[model samples]
Target: MGKVTAQTRLANQLLLEAIKNPKNLPVLSLADWELLIRMGRRTRLLGRLEADLSRIGLLAEIPSRAADHLRAARNVIDHRNTLVKWEINRILWALNGTEAPIILLKGAAYVQANLPPAHGRIFADVDLLRPEERIEEIEEKLSLRGWLKMQIDPYDDRYYRVWMHEIPPLRHRERGTEIDIHHRILPRTSRLNSDPALLFEAARPLEDSRLHVLAPADMVLHALVHLFLECDPREGLRLRDLLDVHLLFQHYGQEQSFWDGLTPRAYKLGLERPLFYGLRFALRFFDTPIPQTVRSEIKNAGPRWPMLWLMDHLVALAILPGHPDYPYPWATLARHLLYLRAHWLKMPPLMLARHLLYKAYLRSRGVRGKVDLAKLDLRQQ
Candidate 1:
């Protein structure tokens, strides 16, 4: 890993400590505040700092210019939460007309569960997990209600329908709100067999809502699975993800069975490596509460040997913020390698080869891997 700079260390220290315990933070100089806010903003976490500092009466002590950004972040977050609720209502109402189970995943799940991580989170949009049997019916229902599927090249569309875990994203006709309809957490082609029934059986519903969210243990496991799969290095997937795991641990990790249950649960789902990394980083970054037995079992569960060394260095370099003036070239390399690893692990060799060939064909024709919605002129629903 690259040498940690003063900016990176200070930012990590502040953000890490804020996650560990947000109350009674020490006052900082202007330079410190600048680095802290910038890193927080990049990770979509400035709002957490704002809310925490305000809760402890330290918000007034920061530089007014810095405070302005935090205030604005909090406002943006509040608005985002409202948008999430409206989108949730719209989705549930659309699916309410059907007999299938309506379940929220990730950010939406966190919000429905009332987990602390939901606060100050930048929700992209809602993720809905429905019965695989009902996917066509649900897609048809949403289509009739004006939710249009993304129009991509035929090859990529077939890839999603045939091998992916989720369907092509559905965007609202009037509101422009986007959602992913998922049948499982991992792609169908992945070696891991994450039975959607395991999740559906464990889902708990929100008060007076037709929607259900993952149970506490299931929620944590889903976060772990998503974290390892989505850790892109080129466009860095920030530490906000690890923070989600840590925050969820803070709330639910205290349960005596939570840590013990996570191990067997992930094993059953064929996701020991992702769970291992989640616990490892949560411990390293925030000293998250994990049982020693669980720790011992997972220590050897992650990517092994040379790959392990590579990941340790690369993950740290890529995930941590560096001094703007002295960016490390190796961090970029680490991200590229890990990004490839993520894709490689998602599918077997032959299918991956075909998938790449198809995607390459699309790119040659100017089609992006995941279609860019802005290019399609999306708007808020």
Candidate 2:
């Protein structure tokens, strides 16, 4: 990581303090509030910050400018929430005749379930998990109704169909909303084995709707996998995503059953590692209220001290939001390393090397293939 300046350190501390303890925000001067707002906006946590403050009955206590920005973010989230609901309705309408079960994933699921993570969160598209065998049928049904495949390169399309967990995202021709259909959580070639069947079995249906969402424990597990495995650190550690996990834990951790089932469920689905990393970081950043016994149980799932020590440094640099005025060279390096680590975890050594070489060859020849799609949009994912 690049050399850290005192100002940058203060910026990081201020933002973390704002999120983790909004009750103390009233003591910050106007200048610090401005910096805090900028950091929150950059990290995509302004809405979450707003929600946190409102939950604690301290929204009106912050500086007026900061409050305005937070409220504005909440307004954007409200509009997107409505669009997501409509998109979900359209999807169900398009697939009206199908017998396949549809389960909502991620942000859309959080919204429909009235879960804590949905508060002040944005949604870019709908993600649905369905039976693997029925994928083509569902694809065809949606195609007939106007949702069409995103016009990505044919090679990338084949790669997704053959190796990836989800197909290339589909965009509606008229409405321009996107949808990602998945058969499983991780890619087919991933080392970890999180079965779609198990997710389906544990899913709970939404009230007065045909749709379902992963059970509370499963939902948290899925969020962990998505955060630790699927995300590209190059874009930013997506602190907002980590905050989602924090909020989910804070909401669901109230029940003894939720805590009892979480670790066992992770072990059953081969997601224990993600659980370990998720819990570790969530506690570090937000002091998420995980039980002491649960923490001890998850310790066995982590790497040895040497590797864990290295990962602690890498994740700290890569996951934390950087100051807008001063970017760190070391943080960029950490992000690149973690980016490769993400790809390595997704595919075995030989396949990953081949994939990287092929993508590199395309880059050398000025061929823009799937690499373009790899560029992340924080608002979207």
Candidate 3:
């Protein structure tokens, strides 16, 4: 664990600021400014990452044609605004001919509610929720419009179908955008069995359409559950996700009845741990006004200390990559091994082993040209 050089720290700050407001690129640290300039000139490198970024809906603000050039240049970035506008347009289009209700989740809802329109937060995909009955019809409509079923492995597809709430991923042929159309937030394997109708019934109009956004309490709960499912304890577990909870709680401080309603729902659903962690972090880091009664209620619902500690470490590892900032290398590896063991328990033993072997083969191929493993003797360690 070595101290980050002053130069690296400045570069990190500039990177954060760039994500916050890409249009202010001129104000970045000198080192970062240099790197940006150099990257702007590297046509191949810039082209590839930009294409990947645009494919993932990260450059939605920039017109697709113009985004190609800007993503390749030193031009001050305004890509996030483009992405927000583009998502809104897409949602509007999806609603045009359909009577089915749409529920916007995660980053899209947060940006609409909290951040400035042009802030440069990156979202890899948009998630939407529709009725279980409409899943087939909606998939058909989207498929007709160039959104096709993702070509994932059969085992992974079955995993989602059986254990999860949604189908496999869908990628738009034209826009190259990916969307996860979910009927429920948590996996089916979890104890939480909230009615999809409740989400629709609670819909609020965002403009002309009666689209559903989670109630503030439910939104916070959803964010926590998402992070827990991802199992990445890092700040990078989607900084925007945590920011959404923080900003929402700040804007709408809930009362006793809110806590009363949430507690029973959470306990019954077995989401107590994720909910507790979400609330704890939101209240801890941000100035969220949680009343004492509500605090006590959540505390009682939360898991015991050891589980909390594990979650805390996982979150840390997710946000901060290396040691000192997180657990030591061996400890982190052991933790991940245990996590994989649990994940494998949900699948057939042979399927799990095959998947692991395939993953190892891919990893070895990825490193083949980059490292001389014979000299390093990786197996000795």
Candidate 4:
């Protein structure tokens, strides 16, 4: 096969976005349109991307059967509200009876916030949080209900349990859904540590029941960390996640101290880079009105500039692809290299080798791949 040019890769990304938002489709030049239309129909994935778009209100402008198929796949993954309510009840019931404080995260809390219902989102797994000590017991309980522990490699499991923040993902035999049970946010190895008890203590009751969820600030911070720090390459950062941050920030604007708290909290947790990237991108793309003090503080944290820039580009590529909205070519990757070098300088040789070995293993298992660097628009600069 011929090497895929950056232009081609970008065109593919733009086309996917166009398919999701049909209004943008017509604006594509004829050559771009041909390329997009060809690629749009080629996905082999089993999920409904169309229903997800509709659920998020992006389908109105780009209405098409193609989009509908995507939506259908999303519907397949996402449980109906009734089902979600029932599942929430099941988990809540279990937690309440056992004295385990259940802290709902992401979509579960989003739906309860009334910003949008969770039915349209593609949520194959439910994420629930409890105290760290209760994880093994909770897993045992979930096991009895036919939720099996996911059979990852033993080394991966060990790494996750020891260094990572969350347990290995669990799958339900009957429902075929997954759940990520967590006691903290960042990985233990990452040097960022938040008190799980504090998160649980700050939890408030969901609208329908006694089941509690993270406070808005905590939830936003969690989402930001997940998006930037965790670097889930497969799913990428969806527009919905950014929307959540924007909405939550707006809602909590009255709490002037919120952004102030994030600085020390992020620095203490070794999550300053992710938080900086999240806030910068949220403000830049989503028009999130970040406070001036926070912006100044981020500017002052110049050491993380390289990583933050690279992440911004990665996020833009993940979200918008090859379209005009994509960032200038090679900028992020170059900065990322600097960031990596910085880490290489500090980390002990054996520890660094171990981390690289694990990363290589993840890539070998199809977790990472070349990110189409050739498709970048290098000519613009």
- Indicate which candidate wins on lDDT: 2
Query: Pairing residues by index, what is the TM-score of model 3?
Result: 0.65
Give the per-residue Cα lDDT of candidate 2 at 227: 80
User: Which stretches of candidate 4 lie above 4 Å from their native place?
Assistant: 1-85, 93-96, 116-120, 232-244, 254-270, 302-320, 323-349, 358-381
Consecutive 10-residue window with the lowest summed lDDT within model 4: 40-49
Give a tens-digit lDDT track for model 1, residues 86-192. Answer: 88877767766687668889988777667788887778888999889999998988887778888776777888889898998988766778889999999987876
Model 3 scores worst on lDDT over the 10 consecutive residues at 40-49
lDDT of every predicted structure (CA atoms): 0.78, 0.86, 0.56, 0.60
Winning model by TM-score: 2
Q: lDDT order of candidates, best first?
A: 2, 1, 4, 3
- Per-residue CA lDDT of model 3 for 1-381, tens digit only, reads 334334334433443344334554434455454554343332112332343344455655544544545454312223543564576567567656888767777766755554321133455577888888888887887776656676655656777777778888776655667778898876665545556566666656576464657775666677776755554322235434554565555555545566667766576546676677777766643445766766777787666779667756555444322322223453355356445634443345676677667657766776321232224433332
Candidate 2 global TM-score: 0.94
> What is the lDDT for 95 in model 3?
51
Worst 10 residues of 1 by lDDT: 1-10
In the range 1-381, model 4's lDDT, one tens digit per residue, is 123346546665565455345445434565654555444433322232344445456555443544455556565545454465567666655555576667777766665555432434544456788788989998888776656676666777777798677898876555556678988875655545566666777788766546677875677678876654543333344555565566677777668877768777666545566577677777766567888888888775544657556555566655433333334344345345434543344344577688778878887888632222234342331
User: How many angstroms is residue 282 displaced in model 2 relative to the true structure, after the best TM-score fit?
Assistant: 1.1
List candidate 2 segments past 4 Å from native.
Answer: 1-3, 370-381
Question: Each model's TM-score, in the order given?
Answer: 0.91, 0.94, 0.65, 0.68
Q: Write the per-residue lDDT of candidate 2 for residues 1-381, one digit (tens) a residue.
A: 334655567778888888888889888999988888888887778888888889889889988888999999999999999999999999999999788668999998999888888887887889999888989998999988887766666878988999999998887766778899999999999999778799989899998458999999899999988887765756646788898999999999999989988999999999999999999999998999899989998999999989999999888888877677787777788888888888899999999999989888877998865333234342342
- After aligning candidate 2 to the native by TM-score, how far in Å is the CA of 136 from where it should be? 0.7
Return the clash pairs for model 3, or none. 60-82, 60-83, 61-82, 61-83, 233-314, 233-315, 234-315, 234-318, 234-319, 235-319
